[model samples]
Target: MPYTPVNVSLTLTNQQYVALRTVNGTVVLPPGSSGRPDAGGLKGIIVVRQAGNSYLAFERNCPYRPFDACALVSVDRSGLFLRDSCCNSQFNLQGQVIGGPSPFPLRQYSTSLQGSQLNILN
Candidate 1:
């Protein structure tokens, strides 16, 4: 099964939306960093800053068990991949399944960046 999609419109600014709360603490990504924001999505939103102004947004829902409440992905301790503790599924920043039993990658959302604003949709 697939997860439900949501709309997200966020603006990155020092006083607007600068950091994201996480289990580790508030993460402040400069330009090329990955962080989970309290944004829209089935579970939540994980935003990764690529080279230049390119950005990637993904749903935190683990594809292995779409219906499970615990099927959520988080950035691993190494910060190299997103891990779903419920099923031990792992995915890279590009949403590629790299480990565990997951047969599909993480759900990616279309993102459009304009200046300091980012709009995400399914």
Candidate 2:
């Protein structure tokens, strides 16, 4: 089956917004980087690798529990992993709950790439 597409707008600083283009393919954006705090709420980042290629976008929120704050996924030299300082939940790059009480993965959104731009949707 084909994937459904969604549209989302993110408010980011000039620097953070500029960095979005650096990501070539599937990438995870951590808080204080691509994501920024807005009046509406915390906005997450969407990183697209290539046009017409695989695309991934997700919310910074954790799907486990409401009280369990600090659910943000980060990727570095060690790779992608979900870190929740409150509950100490750690997930793999695929958003699988490797450890902790999370029964489901992180909230993921549909993504599409157009030229050098990426569109993230619900």
Candidate 3:
């Protein structure tokens, strides 16, 4: 079964969001991330920064075989996709499966950007 993380409500300052400002830039936060149970009982969160201040956040565990924490996905060398080395699955910045065994896209979280704070909400 695929893991669905807990609800998330996070605020990021411009300075903090800078690191993830570029395309394919990623940040992983622990399960109890930003002081909340964001990852439910799974490993953590995998966030990929996209253009237009949009962001994509999903559980670190790969949907193809989430039971194995080692199946977590990482940004490919090209910085264009998230690749799960274990399963050789590749997901686009938007969490959609581009090349992989996963039948569904990565689970996503809602995000919004204000003057400077970027909020990741459930």
Candidate 4:
């Protein structure tokens, strides 16, 4: 059988959308940033970066146990991995856990860029 895809639309208020720039080819948005979809209490941030000639997007919530309040991740100047300052869990930019107690990778979101505008999909 052929696979079918699901379609969902999100509408955001002006206060929710914020413009950010990619530093050193990567930009990390915190949980309450603009690119994140605010639906169903889905809590996570989006990472927008330039990969070669394309842009990529990833969810900041660690996949091991997203509900864990401590699963939120942050990136540093190294442009390497996302670290959970609360519990010290570390995950690479690709969402792969590189250290700490995380057993899975971080969740990822689909992304599209048009005229410098990036759209992150949940």
Query: All candidates' lDDT scores?
Result: 0.69, 0.49, 0.68, 0.53
lDDT of 3 by residue, 41-118 (tens): 255667777776777777667788778767777778777678889999888878889997888787676777675555
For model 4, the run of ten residues with the poorest summed lDDT: 1-10
Give the runs in model 3 whose Cα sits over 4 Å from its true position.
2-11, 14-16, 33-41
Q: What's the true lDDT of residue 69 in model 3?
A: 61
Scanning candidate 1 in windows of ten residues, the lowest lDDT window is: 24-33
> Candidate 3: worst 10 consecutive residues by lDDT?
32-41
Give residue 77's error in model 2 in angstroms: 6.5
User: What is the number of residue pairs that collide in model 3?
Assistant: 0
Q: Runs in model 2 with CA error above 4 Å?
A: 1-6, 9-43, 46-52
> Which candidate, 2 or 4, has the higher lDDT?
4
Clashes of each: 0, 5, 0, 0
lDDT of prediction 4: 0.53
On residues 46-70, what C-alpha lDDT tens digit does candidate 2 reach at each position?
3534333455565656565633445
By TM-score, how accurate is candidate 1? 0.78
RMSD values, in order shown = 6.7, 6.8, 3.1, 6.6
| 1 versus 4: better TM-score goes to | 1
Candidate 4 on 22-92: residue-level lDDT in tens? 33245544444334333211344545454533555556565556667766677755766678776677876
User: After superposition, which runs of candidate 1 have C-alpha atoms over 4 Å from their true positions?
Assistant: 15-38
Tens digit per residue, CA lDDT, model 1, 39-106 = 56766777876656667777777889789989888888887778899999988878899999999988
Candidate 4 residue spans exceeding 4 A from truth: 1-24, 30-41
